[model samples]
Structure formats: structure tokens, C-alpha cells
Target chain A: MLSETDISAISVTIKLALLSTAILIAIGTPLAWWLSQTKFKFKVVFEAIIALPLILPPTVLGFYLLMTLGSNSPLAGFLEYFGGGSIAFTFSGLVVGSVIYSLPFVVQPLQNSFSAVRIESLEVAATLGASNIDRFFTVAVPLARSGFITAAVLGFAHTVGEFGVVLMIGGNIPGETSVLSIAIYDHVEAMEYSQAHLLAGGLLVASFVMLIFVYLFNRHFSLVRSRDW
Target chain B: MIECQLKINLEGFTLDAKFSVPDQGITVIFGPSGSGKTTLLRAIAGLEKGDSGFLKVGDSIWQTDDNFVPTHKRQIGYVFQDAGLFDHLDVSGNLNYVKKRKTGLKKVFIDSIYTLLDIESLLNRRIGQLSGGEKQRVAIARALLTNPKILLLDEPLSALDLKRKNEILPYLDSLHNQLEIPILYVTHSQDETSRLADHIMLIEDGKIIGNGPINEMLTSFEMPLSHSGDAISIFEARVISRDTDFNLMHLEFNGGQFIVPDNALPIDSLVRIRVAARDVSITKKKQSDTSILNIFPAVVEEIVPEGNAQVIVRLTLNGVVLLACLTRKSSASLKLDKGSSVFVQVKSVAILN
Candidate 1:
């Protein structure tokens, strides 16, 4: 019963979530690893900054991102110098906003998992002739596999459910910036209750499934950890 | 030879140690808790970066002025107290981790190490399925496959209970002569020290107080080992014969022959025996009517008073060192002095290996 525009919106939402999650994982891994290992005095400041997106209103973050990517900003001017147009109200700008909005969703679990990796294990790997990078990939990454799964699922699910940030920076451009939540909002505003229910029910089911996966993964990981001395 | 002069300065503690140990056998770093023994071992492995340090193992320098080789680059194997095995890997995976890292090591040699540590049957099991002793054995086999020039074990048996410690000690004892590399073992247990150490380095208050072969270090009056209430002497002997009727074995040492309760070991096999200072009594003449079977003529070399009541007498029997603890009153009443001849009556001898 969905219209063609609604179908396009679903596809765009999935694409945006996938791309944002890929970028977040690529960048969040080292950041989380550093957060877990650093002994610096000011590490708490960085931790608070990363966690800001969690407590902050998404509209506030979207408002700032809008200003930063708008035609008047230096970022747009620099991109324009490289033959690119203003990113505001575009799919690229939607991705940038979604990445920042869901950063803590990806990074916090990863940092906790990396912190749980015992220092003794890493030191043993080093003595066994594993270099720093080798140790990170072979020991730290595999040991934190549950964290990676949780982070990816949460980042993708949170990005799919994004409403305010996409609305503020992307402005509901069909097939480009218009996503599932925006499409559902449009249906409710037009008083089309059946279409609203369709999208909203789908999203509710998807989010619940993702949460169930995360909890199951966490349980399995804890059980495995307890088996080790 | 492994030569080291390392200094580490922490918030309230400092570790300054310097010594040279032979590139063979087990050299125990003996100390009480919080005495910087672990810190010294870490520095040698390049795990703890000292403020200023110099370490040379064999001909290659690991750390020195303006140069430092990181832990991965240094050819040393380290075993932690908890075994530190990879929980994500099964037993075989843990053992093969080092094999995958280092190329050109023979598969046969690695298999021999597996057999030596008795972990062949455990290759398929998960690390979590292993008992405390099995985990340590796998950890040791994993380290040996790296073909290191020196092995560093930081209280490898401390995490295990007494039953498990006994289970793993034989494997550790065999590692001394089986491998050519020097092994630096850190332990606070006197039993482990006397059982394993070929050389001993005494640490106290973040400094090296004494360093020598285990025989001299254990019996030296100037050292703290002989002054303790549980002081002991260890000696090597060869099984001469076994009296099956009496359940006894005749053993020959550098000092004299000893008759011990039979252990079923074959004749001509080398064994280690421990004689605690408290188990020895001294008399002016050899007692012929006593039930004690082991008596030898010895000369007093030195006497160290242990508090106000007891004295630890260092004796030399046929050039072999032995320790005897006695009441200071008995020593004075008997007029025991340096170079005084006495008959040492050993009450019992415990076979260590």
C-alpha cells in the first residue's frame, strides 16, 4: 500500500544508515581503543565530548551542522574551491549529520569492550613477537568482537530511526535526504493514518529486533568471558 | 651471559638492580612481596621502560644509552602469573600463535616442546576448559616455540593451589637442562627457590642484596637465607642401590653416602635432596646407638645468631655445605666455635627431584 515516493524513502534510509555505519566503525575503532588505553589526565574531557551526542537534543546538533555545511560557511567555500557544491540539504550532508548523531552509540560499547581486554593478554602477545598493530588486530579486535557487533547494530538502527537531524539539515528531499522517519511524519501530517502505521510499525519491529540481538550478544560474550580464568 | 643495570622510579618506590647471571639454567630472583622482584623481571623483558637502563643478552644489546629495543623485537619469552593465555583461542591456537609469528622454526622442534610439556592431548580443548596447571603448561609450551634466548617467568605457579603447583613443578624442573637458554624465574616461595634455582639473586627494598650460585647463597652466613627459622640446604646425589627388603635407597653425594626411604627411582639416576636446618643436630662424638642412620663428621665454618635464642651453624662436610639450627644456649654449652669438629646427625632428607 506504500507509494513510489515512500518506497524510495525507505531505500534512501537504508543507504544512509549503511554508509554512516561504515564510516563510524572505520573511525570509532581507533578512537575507542585510544580511549580504553590512554592514561592521560584529561581523558575524561574527551570521553564527555564523545558522550555529548547521547544527552544532546538531535535538533541542536542538526542546527549546528546546518550552519557548518551551509553556503555561507568556510567548509562549503573550501569544498566549492574543489568544485563541489554546498552539502546542506543533500544526501552527503544527511550522512555527516547522522554520523555525529550516532557516534556515542557506536563508540561507547567499543570502548567498554576494549577496556575489558586484560593488559596481561596484550603483553603476552607482545612478548610472543606481535607488534603493536598486530596486537591490535589479532588480540584486541577479536577479543572485542561482541563490542563491534553491538556498535554496528546500534549505529545502523539509530541512524535508520533518525528524525530531527535529517529534517533540520536535509529538509525532506525525496529519493535523496527523505528517510523512513521523515516519510512517516509526512504521512501523519497529511492525516493518512494507515500509511503512518505501516512505516511506524515496521520501524518499531526493526528497532526491537536490533535491541534483542544486542542483549543476546552481550549475554553470550559475558558467558564466554566467565569461562576464562 | 645476561647483564643488566636497570632503574625504575615510580611515585613512591624505586627499583635499582644490577647483576650478571649465567646464560644457562634457572636463575631465581628471590624476594619478599613488594620487593621489586617483578619490576626487575619486567625491565629485563623490556616491558617496563626504566628511566635509564642497560641490558645485554649474549652479544646483542637490548637497551642502552640512546637506544632501546621494544618488547616484540627482543628475543625473550615471558610467562605471567596467571598464564595469560588467549581466552579467545583454544589450546592449539594458543600454542600455534607463536609459531605463526616466527618463521623458520622446525615443526619437529615445536612438537618436541609439546611432548616435553605434556600438552599434546590438550591441543583441541578450549583454554577455558583447561585446569590451572594445564593452562600454565600450554603457556610454557607457547613460549618455548618462540625459540627465545632467555625466558622470563613471573611467578608462573603462584596462581595455582598447592595440588596444581605440584603438578606443574616437574615440568618446570625439566625445563632447566632441556633448553639451552637462560631462564629468569621470579618467586617468593623458598621451596620453589631451593628446588629450581641454579643461581640465586636476593632482592630487598628495591635492590639486589646478594647474587651467587644457589649452593653458596643458601648456606652463606652473610645472607638472610641461612638466618631464617626455615633455613635449608640442597645437594645433588646419585642413586647407588635400593634395599627392597628394607624399603631404603643408598645415595652417594660429594660429602658421603646417605640411606633414604625408597622412591622407586632406578639406580644411577641423579636426584636432589633437601636437608632443613632444623632437622640437623650436632654432637661432640658420633652417636652409634641412635636410630639416626645418616651421620657425618663436619667442621663448623660460621655461626649466625637468629634472634636472642637460636643460632644457625654453617658446616662443611667433605667440602659440601650444610646448615644446622641450634639453641644459642646449647651452642655455648657445647663450646661450638669456628673450625670446631662436630658430628652432624641428619634426622630426615626430603627428595625434591
Candidate 2:
């Protein structure tokens, strides 16, 4: 019973979540690694600031990002001068907002995973003549794979459920930034109960399945770790 | 020769140690816990940066005033106390990790390592599925695959039980004999030192108290080694004959013949034997009839009082010096003193190699 517009909205939501999750993982992994291993002063303060999105209202974040990346802002003006165009009310804008709003969901798990990696293993790799990058790829990445999986799932799922930030920054433009959540809201406002129910049910099932997979995978990871020890 | 002189100041303790080890054979850093043994090993491997030091490994200076090579640049294999194997990789994957990264690919042979450590059966098993002893063995094999110039073993056997230690000792002996690479082995257990070390460096309070051949340094009574329980005299012996009638093996050393209880060794094979101080008894005169079969003439060199109840006696038997521990009551009852001619009765001797 889903309409063509509803399918287009679902596809847009999937595309935005996937793209944002990929970007977040690529940028967040190194940041989380540095945060986990460093002993510098004010590290906790930086961590707290990175985690602010978890507690701060998503609309507040969307408002700040909307203003900062709009055409009137210096960032958009700089991009416009370079012929890149403005970022607000675009697909890229939704991606940028989703990455910021779900930053902690991707970073916290990665940081914890990198922290749980045994330092002695890294030292042993070094003594075995493995270079720094080699050691990171061979030892750190493989051992922290569970954390990566958790971070990816949480980031992707959280991005799919994002509403306030996308609404504020993206303006619900159809076939561009209007994701499934916004479409469901619009359908309800128009008294189209069937379409709204279908979209809502699909998201509920998808989120539930992703969360279930995370829990099952985490249990398997812990069992493997204990057996190894 | 490998010479190291390092002076590093930590929070509560300062490590100022200087020693030169031979280019081959195992040099054991024997000390008690919290005595900076592991720290010294780490410094040599360049994992730890010392305040000011010079490390010269046969013309290659790793660390000096202006040059400080990091650990990855230094070609040293370090085996930790816990056998820090990568839990995510299987044994073969762990071995191949270093093998694939090696530049020259000259000395390391995978099959040879598998044969040496008997890890052929464990190649498919995950590191998490391996037992403690198996993990340590795989760790050693993995380190060897890196084709390092030297091997640094920091108490690799400290985490295992006695049975596991016994199981892993032979592989270590084979490594010492076959590899032809210098090994810096750190340990607090005297039993491990006596069994595996060729050159022993006695470390106390972050200083080298004694450094020499294992047999000479252990029996010399000039250092704190005389106080350790498993302190014994090691002698190089060749198997002269095997008496199957009495289930005994006859071996010849500097002083005379000795009958040791051991099997699985061929005749004329060179072996090292350790005679514990507590297993040896000194007699004023040679006895004619007794259940003990091994007896040799010895002269008392010195007597060291170990504590209120026990005393350590140093004796020179022919050209070899041996140590024996006895109770103060027995020493007094026998009227034992320096320059006394006595017969040493060895109750039991352990074959180390």
C-alpha cells in the first residue's frame, strides 16, 4: 500500500544514513583512537565536548549548524567563493548534520574499543619489527573489530531515526532531503494513516533488528574474549 | 660483544646498570621481583627510553647521546611474561604477519620454527583457544619468525605452572643450542637460570652484582647467589658409559665419575648436570658402605653463614668448585671448618641439558 512518494522518501533516508555513517566512521576512527591513547591535559574536556551531541537537543545542534553553514555564514561564503555552493538545505547538509548529531554514537564505541586493546600486544609487535602503521592494522584493528561493528550499526541506526536536526537544516525538501521520518510526519498531518503506519512499522522493525544484531554480536565477542583468556 | 650502559631515573627507583654480554649464548639477568630486570630488557629493545645511555650491539649503536632509534627500527625480538599473542589471529596468521613484512627473508624458515618448537599441530588453532604453555610456545615461534638479531625473553615462563614449565624447558634448550643468536633472558627463578643460562648476570638493586659463566658465578659464594635455594654447581660432562644392569648412567667431569639417574640420552653425548646445595652432604672421612654411590674428595674453601639455622659451605673438589648447604648444628657437630679435607656425598643431581 506504499505510494511512489513514500518509496522515494525511504530510499532517500537509506541513502543519507549510509553516506553519513560511512563519513562518520572514516573521520571518527582516527579521532577516537587519538582520544583513547593520549594522556594530554584537557583530554577529558575534549571528550565531554565531543559527547555533547548525546545530551544536547538535536534541534539546537541543527540550528547552530544551519546558521554556521548557511550562505550568510563565513563557511558558506568561503565555499561559494571556491564555486562549491552553499551547504544548507541540501543532501550534503543532511549528511553533515547527521554526522554531528550522531557523533558520539560512532565515537564512543570506537574509543572504548581502542582503549580495550592490550598495549603489550602493540609493544610486542614493535619488537617484532612491525612498523607503527603495520602494528595498527595487524593488531589494533583486528582486536577492536567488535567495537567497529557496534559503532557502525549504532551510527547507521541513529542516523536513520534522526528527525530534529534533519528537519531544521534540510527543510524537508522532497526527493532531496525529505527522509522517511519527515515523510511519515507529513502523512500523519494530512490524515493519511495507512501510509504513515507502513513507514513507521518499517522503521521500527529495522531499528529493532539492528539493535538485536548489536546485542548478539557483542555477546559473541565477549564469549570469544573470555575463551581466549 | 653487546655492551650497554644506561642510567635512568624513575619516580622512586633509579636504574644504573652497565654490562657487556657475549655475542652468543643466553645471558640471564637473574634478580628478585621489582629489581628492574624487565626494565633493563625493555631498555635494550628500545621500548623504553633511558635518560642517558649507550647501547652497542656489535658496532650498531641503537641509543646514544643524539641518536635514539625507536623499538620498531631495532631488530630485536621481545617475548613478554604473558606471551602477548594477538588473540584475533590464529597461530599461522600470527607467524605469517611478521614473515610477510620481513625485507630480506634470509634466515627465518617457517618449517624450521614449526619443527623446533613443535608447533605444527597448533598452526590452525586460534590464539584464544590455546593453553598457556601453547601460547608461550607460539609467541616464541612468532618472535623467531621476525628474523631478529637478538631475542629478549622477559620471564616468559613466569605465568605457567610447574608442569608447564617442565614441558617448555626442552624447547628453550633447543633454541639455545640451535639458533646461534644472542638471548637476553630475564628471570627471578634460580631453577630456570641454572637450567638454561650459559652466562649469568646477577642483578641486585638495579646493579650487576656478578657476571660470569653460570657455573662459576653460581658456586662462587662471593655474591648473593649463594643464598638462593636452587643455587647449584653446573658441570659439563660427557657420557662415558651406561650401565643397564643397575639403571644408571656414568658421566665424567673435572673431578671424577658420577652416576646420574637419567634416560633417553645416548652414550658419549655431552650434557650439563646441576647438583643442588641441599642435595650434597660433606663428611669428614670417606665412608666404605652406604646406600649412596657417588662420593668425591673435597677441601673446604669457605663457610658462609646463611641464617640462624643454615650455613652454606664452599668446597673445591679437584678443579671444580661446588656449594653445599647444611644446618648450623650439623656443621658444629662435625666440627667443619676451612681447610678441612672432606668427602662430598651427592644425594641427587638434575640433568639440565
Using TM-score as the measure, which candidate wins? Answer: 1
- Lowest summed-lDDT stretch of 10 residues in model 2 chain A? A220-229
Q: What DockQ does each candidate score versus the true complex, computed on alpha carbons?
A: 0.70, 0.64
- Candidate 2: where is the Cα deviation over 4 Å? B104-108, B228-231, B262-264, B289-291, B327-340
Clashes of each: 0, 0
DockQ winner among the candidates?
Answer: 1
TM-score of 1: 0.98
- Candidate 2 lDDT, tens digit per residue, B1-353? 99999887777877888999998999999989888898899889987787799998876789897889899888788899999888777888888778887766655477888899999999899888888899899999888887778899999999999999988999999999898789999998878888889999988778878898988888887877777665688888889997888788998988889997757699999888889999999888898887788899999988888878989998988978899999889899989999999999999888877
- List ranges where model 1 is wrong by over 4 Å: none
lDDT of 1 by residue, A102-219 (tens): 9999999999999999988899999999999999999999999999999999999999998999999999999998999999999999999999999999999989998999899889
lDDT of 1 at B70: 96
Q: What is model 2's DockQ versus the real complex?
A: 0.64
Sliding window of 10 residues with minimal summed lDDT for model 1 chain B: B42-51
